[model samples]
Target chain A: MGWFRKKEKPQEVVTEKKDLWTICPSCKAHVYKDEWDKNFSVCPQCNFHDKINWKERMDILLDPGTFREINDNVSTADPLEFKDSKGSYAEKAEATKVKTGMKEAVITGRGKIHGIRVVMAVMDFRFLGGSLASGTGEKILLASEYALRHKYPYIVVSASGGARMHEGIISLMQMAKTCAGVARLKKMGIPYISILTDPTTGGVSASFATMGDINIAEPKALIGFAGRRVIEETIKQKLPDDFQTAEYVLDHGFIDQIVNRKEMKNFLYKVLRYWKAK
Target chain B: MNLDFEKNAPEIEEKIAELTKQKATDPNAKVDDQIVGLKKELDKVLKEAYAHLTPWQTVQVARHPNRPLLRDYIAGMCGEFIELHGDRCFGDDKGIIGGFATIADSHVMIIGHQKGKNLEDNVKSNFGMATPEGYRKALRLMKLAEKFKIPIITFIDTPGAYPGADAEARGQAEAIARNLTEMSQLEVPVIVVVTGEGGSGGALGIGVGDVILMLSNSVYSVISPEGCASILWRDGSKAPEAAEALKITANSLFKLGIVDEIIPEPIGGAHRDYDGTLQAVKQALLKHLNILRRVSERKLVDRRFEKYCRIGRFKHR
Candidate 1:
């Protein structure tokens, strides 16, 4: 004797599929994809900055045709012979390369941002959630070394889930390795500006992401060392709505500032200009 | 309910316990012979079990609740220890304890991760999971050690860094990163010992050193065996198999040149003989310190950097 009852079926109406309209995760507003792109993937309704891939990030941040990539050929080898339920790490690497069209998760290069030449390393979260593999660490070190050698401002836009688990302890060593590179750059007095984008957590956040002299985050960017779910479960408490968000980090002083995607360029130029003047 | 190793020696343990209990209950009962015989049998069982322990079994022993924690080791080894608290950037984290201490007539800054002795202490210490504040506090102490030219000694024993949202918010990664960055070039000798579980970046937070020591029974890896098992097989029960494949035991790490020395534990485990283990660690520390202190400060820093730089190596062929 169940109280639940089957209800009458209503007539179905089919509407034309609209690929252009996408819903904002935060605001739940239907926004045109083109409009979102024009606004740098930041939802106009609620200013929720959507995660951007490295190529898109580069195009927006770097001057057109002025970017020169460094350490572009370094890719990860299946050092540990790691295999998982999905497949081997090598197979995943190949698949991720095809999907993301990049050899590694991080793209290290020298580029002009608002006429201020800087060495930049932009991470693509699409590739293995931007897990810092040995190659990623090598690339970051190379970028920092390049910045030090050329005396350019070093910038790294982080959007990673943290260390590459498949690579095992070899992946964990990157945290120390990259930090060592940053230490050298700092000792040489090179400016490092860490830009935290949406979904930067894990080993990536724990290491170089937070070591920036001038740490910046995009509006509503998710930046933290651990995942939200991991934290909530461990603490046995419900978290605040804004926890681990850019606004929350800014309030806590972990980051220097939170810039909207549109005005971030101007803010970088202003900071660069101040340093230049000094 | 029992340790994996204990379960392996259940018959011997039961006999020993029963005999010991009988002696305690009946004053006139001559159970000394039975207790001694059972103890001998238990020893033999322990030896056999430990000698042939699977990686998962080793993991269990490494995380045994009765294992002597950082506090016990510090109390036993260091003389005139004064605890310094707080990161100064945030509140003090009890997960990591550090202070000025004297060891073998040399003043050193000793730091380690403390997994509390009992349930209440464990809860309070976040089960040895360090937060950003803990790493920050460690960095503060390391910097202080550099200022006074005190040798840095860190006893590592954490599952990993705290993976909580608030910890991440406060910059757990950055804190660990900064420690790695700053400690690399500190103008003082840094010695690291893996007294227990050395899980991933949490251990590496203070891991960069002139000499890295690990207990024979300890295991270190990027991810825990259970974590690896879940990811690799979608089954946590596959941890035993995953542990075998991860090659995280002290012997494996030593063979891979990831660890400089392996401090042999007591016959059963460190937990069974705290004083013996402490004395052995102290001796190992003195031996390493005597050699490390002879190296010039610049050379020490260079070697430390070089040591980490050469950790992972493989041939294309």
Candidate 2:
């Protein structure tokens, strides 16, 4: 070790080049922060659509001056008191508000779409890890009950990552809860429609999303019960190009149609009229 | 090598392999004719074998990749679809899919499980395993249907609820139990179609209905053959034999009075002729819905409850 010791000569160091971030054409890169507000937080560059909260979606989808949200006071409790790296349910809920600006994962209420009375339940991915925990399950159950009582068509806009991690098994129970509620509605013989937006994955896909009397998907929506990566690992094979996309699902006969956002309301109007006639 | 005798064994396999290869190379290859011929041969063997399928074969058919899933039925049968999200509690589950749509002139609520066609989709949908939230979402949609006075339809195709650590932590068993209790008294005319594998509690989570219809090749069982084997023999390999004991095939279940009716599949299977399978499903659903329309709410609920209770009550004497 002593023999290998050598004197070092001083040398000039070169400065490392910084990465040049380009604005994505679809999702506008760094621009004036205020500019995003005008665009509804959608990327100004490439028109990449950012996830919107349930409230914003309601404002956009429902008829003006016809929305009346229900069960806003309901919240979750630490029944199991699950904890993880994300922190406890209490901490997560507070942080979620700061991050996603929502109180819960879903908002259920009565609303009118083109003057057709409907019960609406929209899930917001921003709150509580976008997971379906007991609170979300209960709210949906309540919404279904409301719809059944009022004889209104039920409409739900879905966007979720899966069951909530904090609530543990209670989150998983919602599958049965929601299914039972839907079963009750089925006995009542009312119309129910599910609009599958982007990234409708996990348990949500397994239960009501696939259960709709009419199942519609947004263009390019990623819809499946399991994630693509998980399936790949299980099957030990590469997936097809389209895989869970709306177009691919349509071709495979999973989705009835893939409608654009602009056409969704009109299409729904027609469906509602048909069902109402009968 | 006796070529003549050897030919029969490999013929179907060879044809399928050839067509698969051609399909890989040529996206537009019209192998439909070849596939049709092979399917006919396969169907003859299947009808002969399936008519006498052990519990395990039924399980395999129920889990077949080519089998028509709930999504497939909805796409083929309904005109428009609008998906609903979230259980309105903690989060939204992907295991269950529900919303509103139209069947001919009638507006209806539709719900079902969506198993993925490939790996990614399967994981996304949790292999069609419902969580508590999924059930809750179904509950939400059901209430909505009741409010609107629209009919409700459910297409069940799940192996079971997720048995993973996370799912158990989230209350899987209790949720399924609740569904069993609550669905019995729902006021709507609930129609359930077991389009594919209906495994245990997961299927039961959404299984209650005034009219329960099962596809020709579909199977509904308390537990999957592998699960049964694991419990009974402590070996997964014994699933074939265990399947024989389960008597889970649609025909067997129909005979046992577990299932209300068995909807016929196209010759061979649903995968061979998706359109034809859709037609059959549509006709069956319409027929059932028509009959259900005349039933009073109280009668429907009572009948549905009684139907499930009547299972496995045969005299032992």
Candidate 3:
């Protein structure tokens, strides 16, 4: 008798209008998340550059599904057993691992950029502020070694605060370790292009991040040897508004060129093509 | 003028000065016995204090105003020294001094972080902090040394590279990176000594070497304990605790396998006995150089690269 006279129609799918937006660091404009992601996290109105996570960074730089990560098993040793008022260094790293879903600050892999095979290491600023630790250094060195053996172009995109202080001297030595790794490629005349993003300072800035055959950076990226506040304190003078910007260093002859995020992949492809012999 | 751990040092020094002044005024002043006794007591005090120096105290000793510097070492060991200056791209950086010199009859390129002995000198050298040009000059000299088939010896004593606007504008990072990359394949034996404050990347700019030596009371840290405390604890007063945790002392660094050998200092520290410290450093240099001289140039470069390559303590799973 209750022959379903009227099955309730499926609820009409409501278009999600939830406010997901990115606040541009420079212009403070709220860009819709989808639009921002589509633009590689760049602001549409002000055209300000925003940092992307490692996954986004990889996807933006590499061919679809072509990345095979190398040295993925490397992890920190907590060499110092460092503990601070915040927490233990080992525990902090573990938490960062869970949060960032990354083993170390840097992720090294082999991938194709515009169908050109290359080995690359890209730093994730989300992971412990992209501080270089033993694991980061090891992964970079191993990747560089792989590139050297294969005679492939090596590229490193650096976005870091500096050395991870928890590892102490080991953290500082990562500079030397990574530089030696890069030097190997340099000695063999391999193309090493260093793409510096915003806020590349301190130990990383003073290491392989700067030692590139072609050093290019993003527009308005803060690239310098020391922190701006540190420089302000030491010099007892206020820095200009554009201090440490990529354009500023370019004017000073520290960097080669500034490439926009959208054009980065194409620019790298061109460089690889230039070095490649058909 | 501030002593971190040696208690009564300033007062004892003042008393010694007073007695010496009195003796000078009155040629027959009977203060010789007192002065000698006080000096003996002072030595005892220094020995006892230095024997138990915490890592923070060692840091202070490393940066002590009167600590013997590269100039003193040059006078003691580098015979027939001629300083080479200028990066040729910019003005000569006074923060680091490099030269061609004979060390025990071997012509080596001697480079070191130079601190001023006086106020004017400090101003000129920027308190031992280097500009980008300083590192560039060092690289220039190391290349020169390689061309001459000579070994390279560098002394690390800076608090750090200058964290200033001009330094950044001038490419401090690139300058240091050049040294790190070029030095690894320079085809010359490189010997490095941490004579004092081994400040972060600044010290490591010229720090790559076949053998790394550190003085007993010297410190090599990624950052000053004060800076660490401020960053981690939001309190600069916790510097002592930070120093302890950082393990910046030579013995600690040696235990961590970062420092190859620790050269012995005097009973107190390097500042207390400059000549003794310099002699010990000279002996260590000669000893290591003799060993390095026997190794082939290719082996030296490869070993140097491998030495730094295997430095980090980490795990791979």
Candidate 4:
């Protein structure tokens, strides 16, 4: 009991460890933050794709100095007026907005890939798990509309847990709303390329993100309809190590191609290269 | 059959059942007036209790074992039903079922999630939680209906798509995702009715239509109240609070314009009187099916897209 209770240790232990290091989450290899960031946060050892913000993804994918945002002012509205035990959804959303410096989970705009103008919607997972709220849906819908009118290839990079619960049924309807927007683009023969990033599941996976003419994914992304824990609980069994990974879904034929982080832009360019503006 | 809200109705009903039994046993025993009095009392209790029900109470009613199901509606409403099976690419999924049916003057292809009445049946149907194959089966039937130029009527009644390992391995997300786009493009009228638990994406797998009808007491939501509570408050016990706030009941969705019509359930609930619930739903299907029959196919598809396209509320300023 005494041995388990307490033990005194020497005080004032000094160490010269620098704080400017980025540890690879998978391989646990230490690398300089500058070097790691220069590689777009992909682990140099294991090549694990770290979750990147919308702006980081924008910089990595879009051509330099060609990005112009649309519906930037459109933002979240508490349709349910939802207040939980912690606090009201509005306050939480506001705090997330301030924390992420994002008006909404999805930032839709016109950008370029290999000098080809395209309408791209990049979702930021930092904004409430990148839940598809009403504002997110509106922005995506507006992006598709803009793409259709301008005859630009409508591309969206989805990184969301699912639909937002604060807005309740309205969030669920966004699934249908966003899908309808994509269906409109497909009908008009606009090139719609959907990119699935690190984590895409639930309503986001079950909507526009999976209906792209050429569905693409980042390497080893967690992509599925239900969460891993939920699947384990429901089936009452241990799942395989790679249950819903991008490679797993590719094997199952859900994803068209699993592109590496460095090669993503090149892959998109190659796919959309032949489709002239029409 | 006895809901927590239906306070004294069960006791009154028991008394009536007992008195009626005595009357049946012996003609000499005059228990008619006593039975009638007890019956009137039960009716009063039921009417008072159902007048104002909490959202949690409504969810209970919607999930009641005695609540009418897809099979019950098929038996009571459809003049003829030819049950279809298999998804062509994979095995048949009993979680969802579809077939050709005639309700009133309209001939339509009907699809719906099926929950079981007992444990064995529920297990067989995976408690109405569809796996990826279930959605694929539905999409196959939907495409068949389109090819035949028949209107599609879908019944949504599930906790959600199955959240299981096998479901994920077979690509549940893409199965539902593909259905949404395909259903939207179908050149035929589509009518959807949320008969019970319209849980999230699974419900929407077959939920899109020109007219969305929800039965009274049925709950439709982005996620189940319990699921929402666990995710938001980190406490599953707060489900009642979550249910109230989510406005999952049929009335709230109707007010929100998520649902087109609210087919009234019998006093107490659909579980109380199966025929009453069946008749209301039959009437709704008949009225809308005929009206849609008159609409041009091109206009129907366009209106369906527009209906879903304008479903969100946001700040634009």
Q: How many clashes does each candidate structure show, in the order listed?
A: 2, 142, 0, 0
Write model 1 residue lDDT over B34-140, tens digit each, in one string.
Answer: 88877787788788778878778888889888888988988898887999999897798889989999986989999989998878988889889998888889989
Q: Please report how far candidate 3 places residue A2 from its true position, in Å.
A: 21
Model 2 residue B227 lDDT score: 57
Cα lDDT for residue B65, candidate 3: 84
Candidate 3 accuracy as lDDT: 0.89
Q: What's the CA error at residue B107 for candidate 2, in Å?
A: 1.7
Which TM-score does chain B of candidate 3 obtain? 0.93
Task: DockQ each candidate and list the results.
Answer: 0.37, 0.01, 0.71, 0.64
lDDT tens digits, residue span A1-278, model 2: 36444332122111111122323345447745456555554556655555677877787778988999898766665544434333455786767767765556889999888999999999987775456766777778779889999999898888887666444334544655676667667778878888887777666765566556787887667766555654565456777767677776566555678765656777888889988485
TM-score of each: 0.89, 0.50, 0.93, 0.95
Rate residue B312 of model 2 by lDDT.
22
By TM-score, rank the candidates, best first.
4, 3, 1, 2
Off by over 4 Å in 4: A1-19, A276-278
Docking class of 3: medium
Better of 2 and 3 by DockQ: 3
Candidate with maximal DockQ: 3
Model 2: residues with Cα > 4 Å off, grouped in runs: A1-278, B1-51, B314-317
TM-score of 3: 0.93
Instruction: Give the alpha carbon lDDT tens digit for every residue of B1-317 in model 2.
Output: 11121225346767888898999899899997888888678667645654554555556656778777767777888899888889887788887998998887778899888899888988889889888788878878887887887788988899887655334334454455446556767778888888888866688778777777888778776556675566445787877755655556777667755568898876556766789999988888788878888988778766765554343222211
Error of 3 at B112 (Å): 0.7
Chain A TM-score values, per prediction: 0.91, 0.82, 0.92, 0.92
| Model 2 interface RMSD, one decimal | 14.7
